[model samples]
Structure formats: C-alpha cells, structure tokens
Target: MKKSTLLIAALMTFGTVKADEGMWTLYNLPQAVYRQMQSEGFLLPYRDLYESKDAIKNAVVNFSGYCSGVVVSPDGLVFTNHHCGFEAIRSHSTVEHDYMLNGFFAKTLADELPNKDMFVSFMREQKDVTPQLESLGYSRCGKDQQAAMVDSLQRALTDSVRQIDPTLHVDIDPFYEGNRHYATVYQDFTDLRLVFTVPKSMGKFGGETDNWMWPRQTCDFSVFRIYADPKTNGPAAYSKDNVPYHPQHWARPSLEGYQVGSFAMTMGYPGSTSRYISSYGIVERRDAENTPRAQVRGVKQEVMRRYMRASEAVRIKYDSKFAQSANYWKNSIGMNKCIDSIGIIQQKRDYEARLRQWQDSTGFLKGQLSFPLLEKLYARRQERVRTMMYWRETFRRTNEFSTRAMQLATGMEVKGPKKNAAKKYHSFADNSNEWDAALDREVLSVLLKNYREHVDARYLPKFYTTIDTRFEGDYTRFVDYLYTRSLLMKKGAKLYYNTKAYKADPGVRFGQDVMDVFYDLNEGMGAINDSIETQERYLCAAKLRMEADLPHYSDANFTMRLSYGQVKEFELGGKPSGYYTTPESIVEKMNRAAHITDYEAEPIMKELLSARDFGRYTDKTTGQMHLCFLTNNDITGGNSGSPMFNGKGELIGLAFDGNWDSLSSDINFDARLARCIGVDIRFVLFMMDKWGHAHRLLREMGL
Candidate 1:
C-alpha cells in the first residue's frame, strides 16, 4: 500500500482509559475523568482544577524547557530537582569552589548567582485547535504537507499572540499523534538565579545505588528564583539591577502528612510515552532501541565513576555529567527487565487481537490493508532500526568529540564558496570547558571500541580499522595519540574556537569520518523512518476510530498534563512494600555505604540524623521525620521535580523517580505496579530550616 493510506491508521497505542490511564491535558479534561478523580478524593472543582485564573496549573512552569518546576514563594522562588539544575551548579564550580560537592546557599539578594541561558516558561493558557487543523483537510494530506500546514497555522497563531504582547512565548503543540493540537501560551522569564541548595550529600543522598529502586530516601530538591526588571516587573535578561519577581500564583506548601490511601495529584510536563504503540514496535524496542544505549553509556559511566571516586576535583568536574549519563543507564536496565517481567509485548499482542475484533464489529476500515502494515513495516526495517540505533548511540551520542567535528564540517559548509579557513568567518560553536583530560579520553576510546565491534563493516568509519591495525585495537593508545596531536584539545580548555585548528584536529578528523558514515546510513534509514512514522500515525487514527465514542487521552509530548492517583503500595517479590520512609534510613544507608563516595554523607548531616533531631517538621502519625513517600500517581521523565499535591491542591511532596517494576509503563502502564516516588514536603522543610538553618527563608515561606 502507498504510505499515504497509512496516515489515518493511528490514534494512540491502545484503548481509551476508563480510569487512571492518561497524562490528561488540564484545559480540556473530560468531565468523566474529573468525576473519577473527585470520587478518588480530589476535592477541587473542575474549573479551579484546570481553567480558572488562579488554577494550580498556573503555579507549575516548564523549568528551562527541560524539566518541570513549581513556583513556591511569592517572591518567585522556584523548586525543582537538584539534578535538574546540575548544569548551572556545575558551570559555576571549580577546583577551588566546588558547588557540586559543597552546595551554595544565597543568604541575601546580592549573593544569588545568575545563569546566562537558564530561563523558566510559565504556560499562561492553552486552547484546543484540533478543529482548526482538521479544517485544513489533514486526512488527505501527506506527512510533510500536513507538517507544513500545521506549521503555517501555528506561526500565524504565535504572531497574533505576540502582536498582543510580544513578551509572551507562544508554541502550538500537537496531541494524540497530531489528531489533536493546542495553542499553548507562555510567559518566559529569562532572569533566574541560585537561591539555596542543600549539599550533594543531602540532595543526591542515596545516589545511583537507589536511583530507580524503591523504599527510598533521597532529598532530590533544589531552590532557584526568578528575577524581573524592577520598573516593569516583567521578564528580562540577566541584570545586576533586576529584583526578585513576585509571581501571580505560587504554591502554598502544606505540612499535612499523607498515607497509603490519601489522594495525590501531579501537574507538570511529562516528556513522552509510546503508551499505545503497536506490538511490533514493542518487540523492536525490546530487542533493538534500549539495549545499545545501556551498553554505550555503561562504558562511559564506569570510566567517569572510577576517576570521580579517585579525586574530589574530578568528582566536582564530572558529578553532573555522570548523573545525566547514569540516569538512563539504570533506566534502560530497569525498563528492559520490566518489559519481559510484565510480559508487556504479549499483552500488546493480546490487545491487538481485541483491536482486530473491534475493527470487524465497528467496520472502521472495512478491514482492508490496515491489518498487518504495522507488523510488516517493522519486520522489514528491523535490521536498519538496530543499525541506526547503534550508530546513533555509539557515534552521535557516546563520542562527545563527534559533535565538535560536525561543527567543523558545518562551519566550512556555511563558508559556502570561500573554500578556505583563512577567511574570517563567524563560526557559532560552543566548546564546554567542563571537560577533563582523563574523562574525555577514556570515554572516546570506549565509544570507538563499541563502534568497531557492533556497527556494520560498510557503515563503520575507516578510522576504526586504522586504529585497530595500527594500535592493535588499543583504544587507550589511540585516544591518547588523537588528543595529544589535536589543537582542539588545547583550545577547548580555554573555551575558544579556531577554524584552521578545528579542521586540522585529529579528533575532529575522525569525527568527520564517523559523520560521513552516519550521513550515508541516515540517508537510507530516512526513507524507512518516514514510512514507519506514517504507519504509526495512521495506527493511532485508526484506533481512535475503532473506539468511536470512548474518552481518549493524548500521548505525552513534553507539554503540561495532570495525572491523579492515590498513595498506595504494591507487592514486589512476594513482599508488600510500605509507602513511606524516614530520616533514620538515611543514617543507616550512609554508614553502610561509606566506602562509596556517592553515598557518603557529610559529618554534620550524619550527626543530626543519628541524634534523632526530628524537630517540629516531624510527622505526628509516625513521630519521625518523613523523608520520602510512594504513590501510584503516573509520571515519567520530564515529570521530575513536579510538585505532588494533596486533595486540597496543597504542595505536599516533589515527584522525583519511578520504581523499577513500572519502567515498562511508558509503553504499557500497569496501574497496580506503576508508582511515583516523591520527597515529602516536610522533609524539605526540615532539611532547609533545621539542617541548613536558613530561618529567614523559612519565615519568607510562611513555615
């Protein structure tokens, strides 16, 4: 069948949810789902819950467009994951002042440090525009044509919105596999500064040891503030004269303790989920997509971990980079296990059988050409998928130097007809000064080793065989040789770029070779991906048709969503795990893991927790400080640092991680097994007030 025929085959990956199976858009939530949430203990009115002037939705902002954060104090003090602000902290750190190891706390306005590009986007409004897009005849349009149509409409909407107020950041986002679209409006504040942060010992507490594992105690919270132009009280770029912003809506944190049966709600941008992808797609991911990522990052993480453990300076240098690398490394491992352990693929196959029956009964397509397109498309492209994934992970992702090389080639292309590096041309390149010689060399060698071992002979760069034959596949020698001769290495240290030096750099030269091979593979893979994507979108539209009148929820696309569930526990390995943990656990875990730097606690934190200094923030029920809690509230990647709210919409905790068992839920959610891990608001108070002793900030928060 022609690819155009598959355009309507998709809606979502599975049947519509009757209960807690959606990352719901706050603006147009189904009344049925709202009532379901109310029955489950949510007390907020639907209007106040979503569309009101001062709704809880207004309090949450997309932090730097990468993670979710909440406005806490009226002074625009923002709360998000410590790991989320890892870049800002890392950039400011040095061998002399190690903010990553010993956290920075701003006691006064002048003490607050400014970040250049870090900014927060508050989505002021969202309006459904699916009907408008449908008017353009989307069903008859090709994929590229459809994209162009959507882009044109989106640009017009953004321009009109800007005409009213140029300060507003406008973006039109697609939902339900582009079957639905929304014009999401935002007010972006460019001035953000460091307010306060607990030490890594407190913020990163259990570290990678307990990353995705439950029964957790990690105070994964950080504090930042938005600064506005003094006269206008509006968004502005970084200025020493700017004052702290007073937001229209900020969350009122409640100290009320919650248990297994209490209601929980999360409002933030959840990154993405294939939630309704086909069974064949599941198989492709199970075998191809996830495994290579684990392999490549695992190698890079180990080398960095070793060097970081060896020195405090190296630890400061690579702490944030390691956290970013190690997060998905563990996630890949957990997700792969969950896929098999839960028999998710088999479940998808079974559901597809039901879908077939539904199609027959509903006469959705008249059962023509729609049946095995998904299966056959993936089957034909499976090898290419693996090849592309491996090439992507190994060359594009793993080798940091590869991108530096790509910049060199692209800079030359932009030079156009000049054909010479001697001419003064603007090369817009950023070489991060965060690199350490030991870490980068080790990472490059390992990535090159994997690329040689795994990628197809034709696709593999010629430089790989050169290293193998000349150096006997000794990655260490090859990297050492490459770095020693490369001027980019020297220039990269000073964070400067030289066009001729970039072209001559051996690292960039090899990077160019890798890119050449990649471009060739990507050219062929491009056609396959186009066909597969068209099939997937068509599959989603067809599923929507099969369901007809059911309440369907859109897939997550890093846009704001509201997910609700109760604070419940589930059995793991025949053991019924409890939903809460205490400060006592941190003390115990620290002493036991003292040998590992990641888990090692500061002497002061240990002294206090060991002394049972629970203070006034202690929970009345447990009579101990609640460190963390578990809820069945559905969450994913960008949901990190999202404020977890009680029935009254009071901030109670910060959603941080998901359990290992539910990792497969991104593709298939098992409501019983899927649980969101959060750091209790009371725990944050205790750490900030008693541990850090920032009493002035406490009074500002009305604690």
Candidate 2:
C-alpha cells in the first residue's frame, strides 16, 4: 500500500478522530482543527482567543498550583471549584469559627480572609523554545541528560527575567514527548483572599457517592479575589495596602443557559494524560500504580472515617486529607474498571501493531523504534515499581508524626550551620496544630501492619525489625512506644542543637529506617527507568512520523489548553442520560440523605432550594433552575476549576469533574463516554443571592 493509504489504515485502526477530541494549545493550533471548531459552533475570532491584548485567555488563572480559575470582574474576583480551595478553607477553620461547616462570605473587602502562601498565576505569554534547545544539542542527548540541560536553561532564563521584573515566574516545559519545548511566563499574585463559599453540606452535597457519577447537582464552586500592588497593579505580597487587581479582561457572566447542542469551550491547565504511551506502559500503570494506590488508600480512609465520625475535631482536621486521598482512590478504581470494560490495553496493542506495520512498509523510523525492547524494559521494572508504590502508600504521609520525623531525619544529613539546622528542625517540629495525636497513632499502626503484609520480607524497613523482635510483631504496641518516647510528638519540643540527642530519638530512628528502604528501592530502578524513558521517546517520535498528516496534540502537562465541544449527553446503563440537572434532583437526593450519608444537606439548604421563586436564575425554556450540565470537552485533573464558555465567549459554568464512564480518558480518549461536568453559572449566582446574601459580589459580576 502507498504511504497515504497505510496512514489512513492506521488511523482507522486507532479511531483517532472519534467525536470532539483533543486538548489543543492555542498558540500552535492547526488551521484544520480551528475550522472544525468553528463548524462545531465556536464564534470567537481566532485572534480574540489568544493573540489580542484583551483575549479570553487573559482572564484564566492557574488557581494556586493544582487547579484552574477565571477572573469574572474587573476587580479580579475569581471563580474556582470548592474542592480546589479545600485546603484554604480547612486552614482557616477553627472550633469557634468553622468556615468549612458554616460557610463564609465577605460582606466587604476587609472581611475577606487572607490566605498564607496562596496565589494565582496568569500566563502572560508562551513561545517556542525548541530552536534554542536544539542548538544546544538537546535532541541528540539522552533523556536524563536533556532533563539536566532543560533545568539549567530554565533557571538561567528565570533569573534573567527576574532581573528585569522580580515578580514574574517562568516555566519551560517539554511538549510532544520532549520533541518540542515552550517557555510560559506568568505573573503570580500572592495576596489572594477568600471572598465567598458555601457550607460543606451544599458545596460537597453529593460527596463520594456522586463524585465521578453523572446526573449530579453538586454546586462545586468557590470565590476569591486577587490583590495587587496599588502603585502599579502588578503582583504583590499580602498587605493591607494592596488593592484588588484590575485585569485587562474578565469573562462576562451570562444568565442565558445552554441547550443540548449549544457550543461549549473550556480553557484551563489540565494536569496529565498518557495518550501516547505504549501498551506495556499502560499494563504497568494499571497493575503497579493504580492497584496499590486503590488498595492502600481504601484501608487508610476507613480508619480516618471511623475516627472522623466519632469526633468533630478529628473530622475538621482530617477532612482535607481524606478528600484528597478519596478523590484519587476512587479515580484509580474507576480507571482500572474502564481499562478492562473498554479493552483499552488491547486497543493500544492493536494500534501499536498497525504503527509497526506502517513503519516497516515505509522505512520510516523502522529500526529506531523497537517494541520488543520496550516490552522487555517494562517487564524488568514492573515488580520493583509495584513494590515502590506499596512502600510509598504505606509510609509517605500516612501519618503526621512519621512525615515530620522523616523531615527532621533528612535535615540531620545536611552539612549546614547548627543554627540553620535548628531552624529547619523547629519548622518541621511546629506542625502540632495540623494533626491529632490519637487519630495519627491509629493510622500509623494500621498502615504499618498493612505494609508488612503486602511487601516482601526483604523490602521491609529496618524499623520492622524493631517491631518484630522487640515489640513481638505488635504494630500498635510499637507505634505507642515511639509516640511516648519521641520528643517530636510533644507540642513544645525543641532541638537544642544536639545532633546526638536528635539521632537517638525513637521517631528519628524510625524515619531514618524508612528513608533507607526508600533509597534502596529507588536506586535499584534507576537504570531500568532510563531504558524505559528512551524507548517511550522513540515510540512517540515514530508515531509522529508515521501519522504526520494527523493533527496530533501533546499530552497534558499542567499547561493552558482549550478544548471545544458541545453541551451533549451520553448513554448510561443503555439509557439516554439528560444533558442537565435541576434543583428537583438535589431535593430528591436530600430526601434520601437519611440512608445515604453523602446526600445529607443542611436544613436551610433544603428550604432555599425548595423555594418556588428562582428569580432570574430560572431557565426560560425549562422554567426551572438548572444545577449542572454535561459537555464533551476533553479535560483532566488540573482543569477542575476551568471556566466553561458559550459560543459568544460568555462564562456559562465552571468545569469541576468528568463522568465515571470516561475514567480511562487519560490513556484512551473514549469520546463517546467522556463528558465534562460543570456547575451552572446561574446556580452559583442563585446560591450567592439567596444563601450568602452576597449581592455585592453578584453586582460586581454585572449580573
């Protein structure tokens, strides 16, 4: 067959263009893709999307480091997911003023709570840096060497940029499996304040039961304001003198709700996707990574759940921790199920086979990409990777004491001044306010036992010997002894600059033992990992050459991307799932809250939602308030707070989640099943007006 015919055959086998797929970067988006987007219903001009000074992309901000958000008012009032702001909410909550439970609304600027170390970043520009790297022989170097070069270059560029403007941040990221690179410059504002939030019962209404499921009504959004230097409206640290930032552009909120086929677009920083990974890599991820994560987190969460249910204090302390753990635990379980149900691994294998045939026929990268070598490398590293995941899940931050103790132990190895060491020790030691002793002790004991049962005897930490021999294999007894004898567990403990005393502490010894095992496991995998990385890069390059005609988008790397689709629905259990949900669904769920704890809500929530008048928030066509809607926009983790815009570039909603059927989308874009779930913008306004009485914020958004 001819090369074009062979490519077509490969495309047919891979099903590359199914539905509205791709998380495309706006800077270098193909004209073909742009035309397709316009055909689908995108009405914004190409220049207005990114190139113009008042572009829509200017309004989008990276929420802290893990999520996305959009500026909605000229005063820099931003909208993001409630769960994305979870840590900030948890930090400000005290027994006297539990913001997590009662909710918080700033009636004025002074009332907005300032958060420490919280910031939002705006991407100023992104330009291709591939030519510069290529001039330095980046393409000819090994993966490890290229990484080092990139690091050096990035630091140099950042330093130069800072010399010109101290507040700008720079990130040089590799794209297309390291075949290309882009430097993104950002201006980070460090004085973000909490503007508004709903109570836990409303913000997290559906909880885990409806976490990744469809037909949902979770109002998963929160509000904040970014403060800037009053002199120049540039980035600034938190201070009373700082004022709300005046952005060049802000998304206009629209009360006009969308229909089943209304155009939808989401622009945000998606965290990760491995769409170009090999079949062997997929198998390893499924068995080694996801399996251990799901299994171990399940055990840990159960312990936390029991303690949390018994004490409100414990619940407040562990709420954020549990949410983070449970979010990914459920995701891993769902991803594994989808991998099997959709035959993702076999599908990858089929695609690989076709690619190899095309390469052999055309002599395009025929000898460079070796599937057998990739397979062998993965096989060699699988067991060690599995053991490492188990080790990580068992010890890494499973409890507060061990985590702090490990930091202290690691600090002991630094050849620094005694004063510097003392400062580091005290910093690690002053975490008493973060965790409860009883709850952490219980968690450590359970995970200790769990770790030993799963890992090999040789892989056990040296502390396991202390437990096995001295404490007679009683994990609880051993844990109790460490807690009692270690000064690290004491609230007012001090180091006193005594290295001998620190080394002799039981908690420090336990920490050292854990680190030793981790170091050993990591060292053993270094060469195997190098080989696998090389093979994967070759595989990616080969695929690019074989299908050069296709509009290939790179895997997500927490960079800003735009995904366009429509407000569409999908089949669930062989039935047509509706495109949107209404307040009635939320009321129905609250009615069943007695049996299903996830559905529980505050009494006031029911009263407000049950009210007859939704005012202007009501959808004219349906004559009811729409809660959440579904779209087919490709998204992943960091897109949590992404703004969903209608064809006219008006903010319609904030994307918070993906449906359960699309859990495998990270590896395989099952366009038919993948759906982005977003909370309606009107619902956000309704809650603000009715529950929070936040008319100031509503008026600021021009609602």
Candidate 3:
C-alpha cells in the first residue's frame, strides 16, 4: 500500500543484482561477489588473489600517479599504455632523433632513457579506518572541516612510516561517498626509464577516429623499467650505480590468447566514477560540466590542429598537449550522448523516488536526505557551474603567456625573504621551448574572443576593458599589444619583481585580472558547493541503508581495484560485434587512410602485418595476429594501462579504453552495453620482436 512497501514488493518481484559489474577492492572483496566470480570462471583461491606476498596484486603499480601498469619480468620491466608514457616520449623527442615518430628501444641498460619526476607506486596494503576516525568525531564534523582532518591524519601516518622506510608513502581516502574511509600504504620507486615503444603510427594507431570505438586495432602499449638501490634493493633516485629492480612478484605474459566467453579480469587504479550520484547530479554533470567542456575544447582543438599540421616543430611540441585535450573532449561528447540515449537521468530519478519513499516509511534520515533540496541547489548553481567550466577550458593552460603570467602574478603576492626567493627562481625560460610564440598568440586571441562571446559580461576579465578602450574592441590587436610590451612573452626573460613595474606590465595585469574573476566566482559559489556536497553525502548514506541487503563496492578514487568479467561481445546496429580484431582490419583501415588520416601508419606497418609467416604470435585457432580484444571488465580513466588477465592470472593484454556506447558507464554501469577494450599481449610481443627486434628484452621475460 505504501511507497516503501511497493519498493520492497518490486525488489522481490524483480531482482536488482547485475553480473559483471563493480570496481571491487581486493582487500575486502565480498564473499558473495567472489562466488559470482567463481561462477564466471575465476580459478585462483581467495588468498592467492590478494593475501599472499606472491599475489598478482603485488605486481600492479600506479603508473606515475596518472595511469596503471604492471611488472612483467624479474628485471622490473613494466608495461603500460602508449598514451600513458606520452609525455615522457614527447620530452625526449627532437627533429634529429624523434623517438615518438620512429620509436625507441634500449639495446643496453645504459641506453635506457631516464625520465624526470617519473615514479611507479606499489600499493602494499589497505585497511578500513572509519572506526578510528569516527572515534575522533570525524562523523560529526561538517563537510568543510573533514578535508583538513583527513589531511592531518594522512600526514601523521606518512611521517610515522617514513621514520622506518623513507620510500613508503601513505594515502587516506574516503569511500562509499564518505560513509567509509580507508588508508592505503604504498612504496614508491622514483628511478624509471623508458625501455621500448612503437612509433606513434603503431602505438596510437587509428588515433582519435577509433578511440573509444569498437573493432579497435591500436597496439596502445609502452615499456619501462624500474631501477633500485643496488645494495639494499630498495627505492632510489636515478644514479648510474642503481641496478634493475628484482620485484617480489611479476605477471607472466601469456601468448595463449583468449576466446569469446573466456574468463577475464582487470586489476588497477581507476580514477573516479559517480555511480552513486543522484538524478539532480546527473543533470548537472550533463548540462553544466560535459556540455561546456565539449563545446570549448572542440573550438580550441581545431586551432591546435591547424598549427600542428603546418609545421613539424609545432606538431612535436604540441602533440602531447593536443592528445590530452582531444581525449577528454571526445569523452565529454560521448558521455553526453550515452547519458541521453540510455535515459540515465530518468532511471536515477525513479531510484531516488524509491529511496525517498524508504526514508519516509522508516523515518530514517528522512529530513537529512532531501531530494528536493538537492534539486534546488543544483538548479541554483547550474549557470555559474557552466560559466566556470567555460572559463577553465578557455584560459586554464590553453595559452602559454597567460599561464606564465598567472604564475608570476601569484608569486608577486608573497612577502619577506620568500618573495625575493620566488623572484630568483622565476624564469620564463623554464619549458619555454615547449610552445611556439606564433601558435600561442593565435590561441590567446581565439580563446579570448570565444570566452567573451560565450560567457556573461560580468564574468569577463578586467583586460577586456583595455581592449575596448585602447584597442577598439579587437581581441587580436589587444593580444598583439600585450605580446609586444610584456617581458613575460620573451623566451629567456627574467623578472625584476619591482611592485610598480610588475603591476604595470600588460602580461601580469592580464593574469591578475583573470585570477580576480576566478577568485570571485569561487568565492561566490563556496557556500553553495559545500551545501551540495553535504546533501550528496547524506543521499549516499540513505541509499546504502535502503539497499543494505545488496553487496556494494565503493566508488573508485584512483585506488587499486579488481573487476572480473568475460571475453565478450555486444550487438551494434542489429548485428553482432566481434570480440577481437585481426591484422586484416589494420590493413583495411590503412587503405582508407587517404580519407581518414587517423588510420595512416608507417609504410613498414603494412608489410609487417601482411606477412604470412607470423611465427608464434599468430593465433592457432584463427591463424591470424589479433590486434585487440573486448572484455566486459569494469574500468575508467586511470585504468588506462591496467593488465587484463586470464583465469590463471596471466597477463593477456593491457586495458586501454571502453566502448563509446557505454561512455556513461562512469555515472551508470550498463552491463549490456559496456565493454573494456584491450590491446592483446601477443600484439605487443609481435611489435617488440618483428618490428623492433627486441629479443634481449623478450628473453628477459622468459618468452
């Protein structure tokens, strides 16, 4: 009779459990989930998966804090997505020796290229800390205060650990939408070096055109090795004396390929997901966040594409930047489309109605978790949020001059000896070679004009007044004037830091004006944002209580998680989409490269792929070299380089992407449509042996 009663009745009549769903934490995987995994063909014992020192979890590493990777050899050889190592590749590339264009392979350990600020972290352990935090009044603290408390706790834990081992690090992150908390211990190895990579033509094969799409042929892999202190065999900084790290455990690379319905699993750090978000939050993400991001980045990327095509130097400098921007730009577009097509907002609303009914019937968190309040708050902030997204995409790191000026402007605010020290360290020459002045000037003018036209007049930076008054409302003229007068535009310029002169400089003034707008927007939305966060947390708590009978996994926060599924395929356009792609697909795409440049590859690629004598890399069943495959494993952004393993825990491939039709998986996981895209391990080995002739490294892996 009552809504809550109806909710219960519906649950009984139609079960809500879905298979092949969840980014499950390994330390405390639910017994029920494990049973389901067993049904799906998981072969290892529970302890073998997580508890033992030789567990596969020990081999997974947080790749430079952005992606996932795995140790695959006794020599600490690591494998990750080509795009994961993109910046390192770009940093080493030059016109004469372009590693990105021609690829790189270290013939000897001494030839391995060292990267600055590159480190891989091995997660040692994770445990719940909610009870401890709750005892210290963490549950009673307001949303604004919890962050500081967590930070203090984390620092104390980290400092205590460093006393014993300086290489160890600690992170305390909230889970289940802050209803639970866990502390993770990690050991970091800082000295990482590039070992092998395929050229961009092969590594980034199919490029943006095939990214997030099915039937992918991209190899999408790169190799690196970790170095440790020779004496202690512990983490160390780069030194000639450092030796190759002999890890306690590593994944065995399997040439034995997978078949449709074969057991598949992925273990790695997934960046973030909003599966617990309310319907109002979905609306906000769609209209306020994804919409503006897609629109602004599309305009910016076109400008970058034009310049990059015109010059090889510009292309090399901006390749990494362009790829980063383009990856998410298309993601936003696909996410929005999937959100609408899947009717995710409507589904969430229906679930929220049931949750509200349950709360009302039980009088549990009835007043605290108010859906109406969430709707009102989101409605009030939608315009400001959209404007903020536009502002961030338009100016934030899009223009080199503006980014440097902002740094100098912030540096000017410090007082005392620190102020002078900051001035001494400040130099425009830092990374000055990464950007072209002509490209930057053009980008500045285009984004400035676009920002003014799209956002409200009140949101415009103060420099717009200078343009109107002095340059007769011409963005190009104003940008040219600033470039001509500002020392910040000079490649090797030094800052004098005189208050009057610094304030009067057009570059600093522009940066300060932009920052002023940013500060104002943030300040105005501070209370509103906090209110929204509080509501969302309570909503999550209420949902957990209502669905207490169901097994739940926490939302991903760039921590290690394992997702299990099968090598499976889905239907597209009323036809079955195959689970794997072959070299034939690669050749077909290349043949059409004249119309679709994304398919263009090195001339050698065609010959190598077309070869009939493919040796052991060829699949025995299909008698073809598989380029990529599909699995139903749950994954997200930071799972880019995650290892996809067969039932025996042998590495079969590296997870690189998700199908475009399931782009809304971040907010809503659709078991029917969602699938993970992985580059086959054999494809990686084929490239290493056939293309690069990397026999020494292959022998090290015992292949």
lDDT top scorer:
3
Report the Cα lDDT for residue 57, model 1.
86
Please count the clashing residue pairs in each candidate, in the order shown. Answer: 11, 0, 0
lDDT of 1 by residue, 63-165 (tens): 9877899998888899998888888888888878877778888888899989978999888888988788888897678778988888898788888888988
By how many angstroms RMSD does model 2 differ from the true structure?
A: 2.6
Q: In model 2, what is the error at residue 121, expressed in angstroms? A: 0.5
lDDT for each residue of candidate 2 in 12-56, tens digit (9 for 90 to 100)? 543336437889888887776776777778888888888898889
lDDT of 2 at 85: 89
Tell me the spans in candidate 3 whose CA falls farther than 4 Å from its real position. 1-17, 412-416, 419-426
Query: Which segments of candidate 2 are over 4 A away from where they belong?
Result: 1-16, 142-144, 159-164, 412-427, 495-500
Cα error of candidate 2 at position 366, Å: 3.8
Write candidate 3's Cα lDDT for 1-703 as tens digits. 9977775654443223566889999999887778777777888999877899889899999999999999999999999999999999999999889998999999999999999999999998888988878888987887657787888888998998899988887899989988899999999999999999999999999888988999899999999999999999999999999999999899999988888889999999999999999898899999999998988888888989999999888899999999999999989999999999999999999998888888889998766877888899999899888899998998789988888877876774233355455455346646766998888988889888888888999999988988999989998899899999987877666656665666678888888898888887887687888888888889888888877756778899999999999999999878999999999889999999999989988999998998877789888878888899999999999999999999999999999999999999999999889999999999999999999999999999999
Per-candidate Cα RMSD to the true structure, in Å, reads 5.0, 2.6, 2.8
Please give the distance, in angstroms, between residue 366's alpha carbon in candidate 3 and its true position after superposition. Answer: 2.1
Q: What is the C-alpha lDDT of each candidate?
A: 0.79, 0.89, 0.90
Per-model TM-score, in order, reads 0.92, 0.95, 0.96
- Ranking of predictions according to lDDT: 3, 2, 1
Q: 360 in model 3: Cα distance from truth in Å?
A: 0.9
